[model samples]
Target chain A: MIPVSVTRDDVAHVARLARLAMSEQELDQMHGYFEAILEHFAKLAAVDTEGVEPTSHPLARANVTREDCVTEPMDRTKLLANAPLADGECFLVPQIMEDE
Target chain B: MNDMADDIGLLNRPAHELAALIRSGEISAVAVTEASLARIEALNPTVKAFLTVTPDLALEAAKATDDALARGEELGPLAGVPIAIKDNLCVDGVLCTCASKILDGYRAVYDATVVERVKAVGMPIVGKTNLDEFAMGSSTENSAFFVTHNPWDLSKVPGGSSGGSAAAVAARMAPLALGSDTGGSIRQPASFCGITGLKTTYGRVSRYGLVGYGSSLDQVGALAADCVDAALLTAVIAGQDPRDTTSADVPVPDYVGELTGDVTGLRVGIVRELMGEGIDPEVRESVLTVARALEGMGASTGEASIPHIDYALPVYYLIGPAEASSNLARFDGMRYGHRTKERAADHIEMYSRTRAEGFGPEVKRRIMTGTYALSAGYYDAYYLKAQKVRTLLRLDVEAALGQFDVLLSPTTPLTAFGIGELVNDPIAMYMADICTFAANLAGVPGLSVPCGFTKAGLPIGAQFTGRAFEEGTILRVGDAYQRATSHHTSLPGLLGAGG
Candidate 1:
C-alpha cells in the first residue's frame, strides 16, 4: 500500500501548482483518485534498482545542432489566424498589472 | 453511387491495389474519392469516427493525382488513396483539435511532417478522426466530442485514443489511416477493431507536428486493413526529419519489399508474464494459437521471462503524465486556443480559468497527478523511482530480445469492454494497457495483428514486438501470419450491408 495518503488539501495544492482550478466536488473526487493511483504505483518500490541509469530516450543520441542559417519564416497573417485575440501583429492578453 | 460502389467498391480493396487501379486508369481518382466520401456520409453518424470531413479538399487532391497520372508522371506508392488522419496531427489550414476544448478554434498553420509526406505522395486526406482529449485515455469515451463506436459491436468501445482511425479502417470508410501511440493507443485500438496497426520505434518516425502527450514515448504510426498495406504506409512515412532532432538518421528500408514471408530461422519468445493471471481466457487462447501457427511455419517458440514486465503500467503512468504535464503547458490561453470569457482580475486568473474550463476530468486528474509526482519534495520517491524502474524494464526487454528475434503477447488483457465499464475506475481503465506498454517503455517497435474473435464475436489481437529499429522483422512475421490465416479478411457485420 502507498505509505502517503492524499487529502483534499493536497489535491487542491497540486492543482494550483499545475495551474488548474478545481471546485470542491472535483477536489474531493481527485483526492480519492490520487490515492488509488498512488497505491497502484506502490508496487514499483519492490524492485531493487541500485546504480541503474535512468533512460530518458529509447535510443542513445546526443543533442543535435545545426548551422545557424536563416530560413523563410511563416507569414504573420497565418500565424495570427488561430489567435484568440490579436491586435495588429501582437497577441492580446488580459492586463498584466493593476493601476496603483 | 451504388453503381460506383459496385464497379470499384473502393472501400473493400487494399490501399496498394487502389493505387495501382488508379494508376492504370481502370478507375478515376475522382470516382474513388466520391465513393469514400459517400461511405463516410452514410456511416459516420453511426460510428462517430470522424470529427471533420473535407470532401472539397479530398476532391482537389484527387483531381491533381488524376492530372499527374494522365501526364504520365511517376508518383509515390500511395497516390490517389483516401486516408484518415488522427486529429492530433497538424494539417495546414485544417482545424487540428486534439479533441480538447482548449484547442477549440485552433487551426494549424503548417503541416505535420507525416502529413506533408503523405500529401506529397498524393494521398487524399478524407477527414480528421476523433481521439481521446489529448490522446490521454485507453477509450474514446474521454473524447470531448462523441465516442467512436466499435464497428464489431456498437455498445463496446473501439479502444482509443486512436479509436477513430481503427474504427474507420474496420468499417471500410478508409483504406489507410494514421495514429499516434504514446503508450498502446494505436495497437490496442487496432486489436479491438480487428485491423493491423504498427507502432514504429521511437525516433523512427518524426514527431514534429504530433501534439505531445508523452514526448519520449509518442510515435506516429499506421493502421490499415492488412500487414502489406500497413508496411506500404510505413515505408512512405518512415525516415529522418531535420526539423525533429530525435528522429534517427537511419536508412529507410524497403519495408514493403522485405516481406519474404519466411520466418523459418526466426526464434520467437512468448513473454511469460504477459499471459499469466488477469488476462481473459479467450484472449490468451488466441495469442497462444498465433504462437502455435508461427511454430508450424518452422519458427521456434519458447517462453522468455521479462521479470520487470509487471511494472510497465505504473512506470508508464508516471513517465507519460510527467512529460504531458510539461508539454501541455503551452496552452495557457494567452496567444491561441480557448480563452475564458469571464472577467479576470489578472493574467493568472485567466490562465487558471481557461484551463479549468478547457480540460476534461481525466486530463485534469493526470495534470494533478504529474504535478504532485514532480513536486519538490516528492520527485525522488515517485518520479525518480519510476524512471529507475523504467531502466530495469528496458534492460529486461533488451535481454529477452537478445535471445529471441521477436516477442509475442496479447495486445490487451481482454477484448473490448463496454464503453462505460471501466471509465469510472481509473486503475481498472489503465489495466487495459498492461500487455502493450512495455514496448513503449523500451522504445521498441510493436505490431498488432488480428488473430481471431472471442466467442461473443469481439476481435482478438496478437502483438509482435521487435528490437529497436527492427520493425522489418516484426512486419515480416506479421505478414507471414496474415498469409497463413484468413482472419484479416473478415469484416465487421455492418460492412456487409453496404456501409
Candidate 2:
C-alpha cells in the first residue's frame, strides 16, 4: 500500500533532489499528481514477490565489455557547439565555489 | 517521363517498390524526393508530424542515390526510399529535439547508429518527426512544441510518443519512419494512425545514439506503410552494432525474405485479460475479427490467460520514470540544451532553473516520480517492487508463449482519442498503453497492424506479439493477415480530400 500521503513538503524535497525549481502552485499540483500515481502503483503490493528475482535488463546478457583501447573522440568544437555558454574550448557555467 | 512521374502515386507506394522503381530507371530518385517534399509541404501544415524538414539533405541524398544507380552501382535494399525519423534519434547536423524545449538549439554532433544504417542503405531522410517530450506520455499532446494530429481525423491525436512518425507514414508524408518503443510508443501510434509498427525485442536493434528514456525498455524500430515495408526496414537496421553493447550478437535475419505469408498451423493465443472490460467494443471487435481471419488461414486460436497482465501499467509507470530520471540527468544548463536567462547566485540555481525552464510538465512530473521512487526510503517499496513484478510479467508472458506461436491483443484499449480529452488526466493517458506495455516489460517483439476502422472513421490496430527473437514469426503472421484483409491498404479520407 502507499504508506504516506504525498505532501507539499515531499514534493519540494523530491523536486530539490531532481534539481527542479517548483513554485508553490506547481508543488501543490505535483503533490496531487504524485498521490494519484503512487496510489495507482499501490496495486503492486498485492503481488506476493516472495522469492522473485528482479529482472532489470530483459535479455539476460552478462558483462558486455569491450577491448580496452583508445579511439578518436568527437571533434571538440562540434561537441561544444551546443553548449549554452562556452569559452571557446570548454563549457562556461555559474560559479562552482560559493563565497566563504 | 514527367507526366509518368506525376501519376506514379509516389507517396502511397511501398518503400521497396519505390526503391525498385528508382533502380529500374523508370523514375529518378530526385523526382520521388521532390514529390515527397511536396506532400510534406501540403500535409504537414495540417498534420504537424515533422519537427524539422531537411529538404536540402533529402534532395542531396536522393541525387547521390540516382548518381550511384546511373553508374551501374548495386544499391542497398532500401535505396532511394524516403523516410522520416522520430526526433529523439540523432541525425548529424540536424536538429534532434525530443519534442521538448530542453533540446532547443541542440543539433546532434553525430548520427545515431540507426541513422547511419538507414543512410548506408541509401534512404533519404526527409525530416525529424515530433514526439512526446523525451518520449514520455502516451499522446503527442505532451509535445512542447505542437501536437501532431491523426491523419484519419484532424481533431484526434496520432498516439505517441512516436505520434509524428506514425502520422507521417499514415498521411503519406513518408513511406517509412523509425520510432523508438518504450512502453508501446511505436505500436500505439501505429495503431492510432493505421500503419504497421514493430517493437523489436530489447536487444534486437541497436540503441546507440538514441536519446535515452527508460534505457532498459527502449528498442528502436520501424513504422511503415505495411508489414512488408516494416520488415524490409527492420532488416536494414537490426544487426548488432559494436557501439551499443546491449544489441544482441545474434545474426540478423533476412526479415523481408522471411515474409512467405505462411501462418498455417500457427498457434495463436488471445490474452483474455487484454480483451475484457476496459477495451472499447469496436477495438475489441477488430481484434476478434483479426483472430477469426487468422483461424480461417488454418491457424488454431485459443483464449490464453496472463494473470499478471493488469499489473503491467503500474510496473511500466514506476520503471519507465525511474530510468528516465537517470537518463535525462545530462540535460543541465551548462553543457547543451536550454539554459535559463535569469541571473543565478550559483551553479545549483542555474541547474535548477535550467531544468525547470527546459522540461515540459510531463517530463518534469516523470522526473519527480522517478526521483521519488528511487529515493532512499521508498526504493524497495516502489522501484524494486516494480522490478520484481517485471520478472513475474516476463515469466507470465513466457509461460503463455510456451503454448502459443504468438499472442494477440488490441494495440490500444480504444481508437484515437480527441486531442485535449485526456491531456489533463495523466492516469487516463497512461491507461492507453496497457495492451502494448507488457510486450516491452517481457522483452518480446510486438507488431501492430491495421485491423479495421471504427464507425467514426478512426483506425483500430491489433497487436501480434512473439517470444524473444521470434520477430520473423510475428511478421509472417502480420503479413498473412494483411494479405487476407484490406484494412492496411485503406487510406485516410483526409489524404484524398487534401491532395
Candidate 3:
C-alpha cells in the first residue's frame, strides 16, 4: 500500500509552484516516487531532534565578507550568445504579463 | 622519453610521468596530445565517456606546453596531460550542458574556476564528458545525451553522475578528469571504474562556475588512475577563490608531496553502521580486506559508530533535491538553453513548458520532490526537520572522526550493476549512495580507492573519509594502499581490443 501523504493533484500543484509543467501521466509517475521516498523520510520523524540546531552549510563561517568593490562582469555579447532569444542587449522573453 | 622515443605507450601512463616526459623534451607535447586523441577516438565509441571531443583545444594547449618547455619555463606537475571536464562545469566557449536537454544549446561565456586552474597548470582541456542531467542520479542513465558504460564490463553502468570522467580515465582516454560530488558522484564512479577519485572538503575547491546542484553539498575534485595523479590534479584545483565566498582561505597543502609511502600509526576506523546490513557480503569483505591492508602497513583499525548515518539517504534525498529545485530554477526559457515551441498564453506557461520539455525524468522527479518538500506547509516538517537532523548527522560524524583519523567503508554496497538493473526502482538506486553521502553532509573529504574486484570481476572500492580539511591524510593512506596493492593496475580489455 502506498502511503498517501500527497495525492496526484498535489504533485501537480507542487510542479506548478516549481514553474515546471507536467502532464497528467508525469504527475502520476511523480506521485508514486514521492510516496516511496517520503515514506522513507518519515523515519526521520522518530529521531529525538529536540534542541538540535539546523545545519544549513556543513562548513559555515560566522560570516563571509567579500570586498564591496567592482568586479569584472561577463561579456554581454558572449552571455547573449548562450541565450535562446536575444534582442540587441536584452533577453527576449515570450511576453511580460498576461492580460488580467 | 629519451628512454623510449616516438611516444608509443604514453597514452596510458600516469599524468605526472607524462608531464615529466614532456618537461624533459623526451616526448614532445604535440606527440603526446596526438597519442591521447588517437586513443580517445579509438576507445570513446564504445566507452561513450566523452560528450564532446575538442581535439583542436587539446592540440592548442599541448602546443603551449611545448612552447613553455622550449622557453625553459617551469611547468606545473600536470603540464601537457589531457583532462576531461564533466559537462556541468563551465569551460569558456565550450559546451556546458550538465547533460540535460534543457541546457543543450548553451555554451559557457566564462570558465569554471577548476577549468581555469586546469588551464593554468598546462593540462589540455580534452573535452567535456557526460553526466546525469543536473547531476541528479546514481547511474549515468539519467544523462540526456547517453549512458556511459563501465569500462570494466560494457554491460554495466559507470556509477554517476561523474560516470563519464571515471570511464575516460579508466579507459585511458585521458590520464586525468575532474568530477563533482554532491553525493558520491565522483567516488562511486571512480570505484566502479577501478580508479581513484577524491571529493575535497566542501570549501576546499572553488565552486564559482559548477552548475549548482546541491549548493552546500557539491564540490569539484579529481578522478585519475591512481593517488599520485589524483593528488597532482587536485592540488591544481584546490584553494581559495574570492569569487566563491564559500571557498575557505585555508592554505593548500602539497598533496602529492605528502604521500610519503608510509602510514605507520595512522588511525583507521571501520564504520560499523556502514559495514553492516544493506551492504553486500563480498563488498563488506573487500572493505575489511582494505582495513587489514592498512593494518599490515602499521595503521591501527577499529570499529567506529555514526548511527545517524543510517538516515543519511533520507536526509540527502530531501536536502539535495530541495537545493536542486532551487538551483535549477534559473533554467527558464528566457536566459539560455531550450525554449518550448508550443504556443503559450503567458510567460509562466513558457517557463513551465520549457522545463517540461527540457528536463529528463530523473531530473523532473527530483525537482518535484524538492518543490514539494520546500513548499509552504511542508517546509518545517520536511526541509527544516531534515536540516536539524543533518546537525545530528554532523555531530555524530564529528564524534566518530574525533576518535579516528579516517573512517572506512565500501564505496558502494556492491560493484557495478547492469545498465537496466535499478533504473525503474528509485529507492534501490538511492540506497547505493548511503555509504558515501554522509561525508558530503559533514563537509569532510572522501577518497575512494580500488580495493579488489568482485567474483564477476567488476571493480570494488573502499571509501576512506577523514576529518574536514584532512584530505592529505586520506590521500596519503590511499597512495600507500595503491603502492602496496595491484588492484588499481588492471585496465579494461576494451582499451586493448578497440580498433
Candidate 4:
C-alpha cells in the first residue's frame, strides 16, 4: 500500500501542478482513485535497480547536427492568420494573475 | 463538364487499374477529386470519420494535376488520387486536433513531411480524419470530439487512434487514408473495420509533424481498401525526411515491384503464442487460411514460439504511459491550446483548472499513472523493470526473425466487440492489445490484411510481421495472397452501396 496519505489538499496541490482545475465532486471522486493509482505504482517500488543504468532511448543517440544553412521559411502571415486570437504579429492570450 | 469520369474513376479505381487508366487517358485527375468529395459528404456524418474537410483546396490541387497532364508533365504514381489524412498529421491550414479538445482549434502552419511528399506526387487531400484523444484508446470512443464507428457494424467501434482513417477507407469515403500507428492503432482498427493497414518500420516513414505519442514507437502508415492501394500510397510517402531526426536514410525500393516478386522459397512463421489463447475461433480460422495460401504458393509455414509475448502488454502499458506523461506536459494551456481561466488565484491554480477541464478521463488516467510510475522511490520498481521486459520482448522478435522471414498472427484477439463492451474497464481495454503490443515494443513493422470474414460478415485481419525495414516483404506476400483470393476485394455491402 502507498504509505503517503493523499488528502483533499494534496489532491488540489497535484492538480495545480498538473494544471487541472477540479471541482469538489471531482476531487472527492479522485481521492480514492489517486490512492489506488499510488498503490499500483507502489508495486514498482519493490523492484531492485541498484546497479542498473538508465537508458533514455532504445536507438543510438547522437547530436542531430545540421549544416549552418539558410532556407525560406513558411510565410509568417499565412501561419499566424489561423490563430483564434492574435495581437500584432503574435498570438494573443488573456492575462494571468501575477502569482499564476 | 470535363467529361473525365473515365479519368477520375481511374483515380478511385484499384491502384493497378488506376495506373492503367492513367496511361490510357480514360480518366483525368480532376474527375477522381470530385467523386471523392461527393462520397465524403454523403458518408462522413454517419461514420463521423472526418474532423475537417478541404474540398476547395482539393479541387484546386486536382485542377493543377489536369493542367500538368495537358502540358505533358510527367506525373508520379498516385497522381490525382484523393487521400484522407488522420487529424494527428499536420496539414497546412487544417486543424491537427489529434481528436483532443486541448488542440481543438489549433491549425497547422505547415504540412508534415509525409503530407508534403504525398502532395508532390499529386494526391489531393480530401480532409483530416478523426482519432482518439492524443491517440490514446483502442476504440475511437476516447476521442474528445466524437467516435468513428465500424463500417461493418455501426454500433461497434472502429479500433483506434486511427479509427477515423480506417473507417473512411472502409466506408469508401476515401479510397485511402493516412494513419499513425503507435500501438495497434492502425492494424487493430483495420481488422475491426475490414480494411488493409500497415505500420511501417519506425523510421521507414518520416514522423516530422506527427504529434508525438510514444515517440519511439509511433509510425505513419496507410489504411486502404486493399494492399495494392496501400503499397502505392506507402511508396509515395515512405522516405527519410531531414526534419525527422529518427528517420532512417535507407533508399525506398519499388514496393510495387516487390508485390509481383515470387513468394516461393519464403520462410513464414506463425507465432504460436498469439494463437491458442483468447483468439476467437473464427479469427483463428481466417489466420489459418492465410497460412495455407502461403504454403500453396511454395512458402514453408510452421509455428515459432515467442515466449516473451506474455510480458509485452505490461511493458507497453508502463512505457507508453510513462512517455505520454512526459510528452503531454507541453499542453499546459498556454501554448495555443485549451486553457482554463481562474480569478484571483496563483499560477498553480491556473494550471490545475486548465488541465482538469481540458483532458478527458482516459488521458488523465494515463497521466496520473505515468506520474506515479516516474515519481521518486517508485521509479526503479515500475519503470526499470518494464524497460528490461521491453528489451526481452525485442530479443524474442530478433531470435524469431533469425528463423523466419516473417511472422503471422490474428491482428486482434476478436472481431469488433460492441461499442460499450470494453470501454468501462481500462485494464480490459488495454488487454485487447495483447497480440499487437509486442510489435510496438520490438520496434518492428506489422501489417494487417483482411484475411477473411466472420460468419456475421465482420472482417478478421491477419497480421504479418517483418524485421525492421522489411515492409516490402510483407506487402509482397499480402499482395500475392490478395491476388489469389477475393477476401480483400470483398467490400462491406452497405459501405460500397451508394450513400
DockQ winner among the candidates?
A: 2
TM-score of every model versus the real structure: 0.98, 0.98, 0.97, 0.91
Error of 2 at B53 (Å): 0.4
Give the Å error, residue B323, model 2. Answer: 0.4
* Clash pairs (backbone) in predicted model 3: none
Quote the positional error of residue B182 for candidate 2 in Å: 0.4
DockQ: the better of candidates 1 and 3: 1
Give the CAPRI rating of model 1: medium
Which lDDT value does model 2 have at B25? 91
Question: Against the true structure, what is model 3's DockQ?
Answer: 0.64
For candidate 4, the per-residue lDDT at B148 reads 84
Give the poorly placed runs of model 3, Cα more than 4 Å off: A1-4, A96-100, B1-8, B497-499
Error of 3 at B362 (Å): 0.9
What are the per-residue Cα lDDT tens digits for candidate 3 across A40-69?
889888888889999999876767886789
Query: What TM-score does candidate 3 reach?
Result: 0.97
Q: State the displacement of the C-alpha of residue B243, model 1, in Å, after optimal TM-score superposition.
A: 0.7
What is the per-residue lDDT of model 3 for residues B105-175, given as tens digits with 9 covering 90 to 100?
78888889999999987889888998888888888999999899998899999999999999999988888
Q: Cα RMSD to native, each candidate? A: 1.4, 1.6, 2.4, 3.3
lDDT of 2 by residue, B339-400 (tens): 99988877778889999999999999999999999998899999999999999999999999
B1-499 in candidate 4: lDDT tens per residue? 3433332333335654664555456766667777778777766788889999999878888888888888888877777778899998998888888888888788898889999988888888999998889989999899988888887888888888799999888877777899988789999999889889999987889989898888878889999878888888889888878898788878998888888847999999999998897899999988999999999999999888788687676567678888888888888665467667554255556666667777898888777656655767656666777786567678789899889999999999999888888887766787667888878877788999998988988999999999988888999988888888887766666544222
